[model samples]
Structures are given as C-alpha cells and as structure tokens.
Target: MRADAKKNYGRILEVARTVIAEHGSDASMRDIARRADVGLATLLRHFPTREAMFEALLCTNLDALTQKAVALESSNPPDVALRSWIREWVEFARSYRGVVTMMAAAHTNPASALYASCAAVHSTSARLLSNAQAEGTARPDMNGDDLFALMTALGWAVDQPSFAPRADHLVHLITSTVLLGRVG
Candidate 1:
C-alpha cells in the first residue's frame, strides 16, 4: 500500500473503532468515513464490505485482549494475575457493548477470523484460570472460562440501565463467588 493508502487504512480502522465503540458494531461505514474525515469511496476502496471491516477490527481487538490475559499469567500470584486479567478484559469490554457481542459472535463462527481469536482467548483464559485454581487462588468450584464468562456477562450487562447499578455488585459477586477470599 502507498503511504496515503496506509494512512487511509489506519484512519478507517480508527474511525471504525470509535464508531463501533460508540454506536455498536452495526455502525455504518458512511458514518465511519465521515468520522475518519475521509470519503465513502475511500472507505470502500479499503474495506470493500462491512463484514470485512468488522472482522478486521474485531480480530485486532480480540488479539490484544487475549495477549493481555496471557501476559497476566506472568504477573505475581495466580489470583492476582486472574484479577488483573479480568480488569483488563473489563476495560476492553466497557469500551463497547459491541466488543463483547463481536467476541461472542466470533466464538460461534468457526470459520471466521473472529472464531480463531475466540479460540485463543478461550485457551489462554483457561490455562491462566487453571493456574489460579491449582494454586488454590481461585474458587475451587469455578474454572477459568467460567470466570471469564462472568466478566463478559457482567460487562455486557453494565451497558443497560437496569444493570448499571449492579456493575460494582456484579464484580464483587464474581470476585467473592469465584475467589472465595483468595484475592492474594
């Protein structure tokens, strides 16, 4: 790609991220282009289709999230690492309801790049969660993916008015229910 093309691509991705993060994954490419300060023709020249664009954006974000979960394993104790992973994931989740929805969609679309990302997230999270459990840091009852599922559910729920007040309570519930006093 030429320098201008590269810039356009970056700009498209940035605008897509912002739009998707703000409006949900169903945000329009025209809106993205307007937000990117680029023309619709330019956006189409780069992305071609909305699925293509959404997949690219989702893949990038999911990769980062999985990497963060894996990275947390290298931190201090198992429980501490798990908490850090959840916090990081929540940060990613809180950015948009679309993020979690995209990820869940990816998990179901086995042939999609999003599916591959979901696989990686599942594997890494399971491994890290196992480490916490083996170390007796996590609640012995719940496994790794369960912990992440809770995070995703709570994170997703926080976007709704009815669930807003329960955000902190949800976090604490997952913590206490899953950690059982294993915060160390």
Candidate 2:
C-alpha cells in the first residue's frame, strides 16, 4: 500500500473503533468516515463491507486474547489460567458493543472475514480447557465448541445495559458449571 493510502486506512479503522465502542457494531460507515475526516468512498474502498470492517477491528483484540491465553498457560496454574483466559475472552467480546452477535454469526460462517479470528479464539479456549481438564480442574466433557458458545453467552450478558453490572457474577457462575469446582 502507498503511504497516504495506508495512513487513510489506519485512520478509518481507528475512527471506526471509537465509533463502534460508543455506538455499536451497527455504527454507521458514513459517521466513521466523518470522524476520520475521510471520504465515504475512501472508507468503502478500504473496508468494502461492514463485515470486513468488523474483521479488521477485531484483529487487534483477538491477537491480544491469543497472546494473553498463551501467557496465562505458562504463568498460572491450570484452573487459574483457564479462568483467567475465560475472563479475558469475555472482556474482548464486551469491548465492542453488539459484537457478540456478529461474532456468533461469523463463527459459523466459514466465508466470513471474521471466521479466522473466531477460529483463533476457539482454538485458544480449547487449549486452555484441555489443559485444565487434563489437570482435573475442569470438566472433561466440555470442548472448544462448548466454551465458544458459553463465551458468546457471556458477551451477550455483558452487552445488556441492565445485566452489565452482573457480568462478573455471570462469568463466575458459568465458569463454575464448566470447571470441576465453583468459581466464586
């Protein structure tokens, strides 16, 4: 990419992140363009679709989540690492307003741009779950698919304005259900 084009692309993504955080995944592309001080055509040229924009926005968070999960596995006890990674996953899902629905949809759609990120998240969760299960800290029956579904539920819980305050409790309860021992 040319320097100016690359700069514009980065600016649009940065603005979109802020707008999406304030508004939602449904945040308007026009508004993002306005915020970024770029033409709508330029934004469209770079992103092409809402899904593509979402995929770009999610790349940073997903990378961080993957890195954090790996770090936790090395640094913490099996159960603790699993729980910590779960909490981080929930936070990642909650960071973008209305992202849970998008993630859920993209998670199953192999053609979606967000699919790779979803797969990476699922893989990370699976590794953590497997480690915990091997250590007898988590239930053996729960797999990566199950953990992904539960994480989506956690995202949904935190997405609601009313339920947001209780998200931590919800996480603890759900973790208890998957882990061998209660979390809270």
- Predicted structure with the largest TM-score when compared to the true one: 2
Question: Each candidate's lDDT (Cα)?
Answer: 0.74, 0.90
Tens digits of lDDT, candidate 1, 15-131: 888888778867988899998999999999888877678767767777888777667777667777777776676666777656677676666678765677677777777777788
Pick out the ten consecutive residues of candidate 2 with the lowest summed lDDT: 175-184
TM-score on alpha carbons, each prediction: 0.83, 0.96
Candidate 2's displacement at residue 167, Å, is 1.2
lDDT score, residue 171, model 1? 65
The TM-score obtained by model 2 is 0.96
- Global local distance difference test of model 1: 0.74
lDDT of 1 at 93: 72
Candidate 2 residue pairs in clash (backbone atoms < 3 Å): none
Candidate 2, backbone clash total:
0
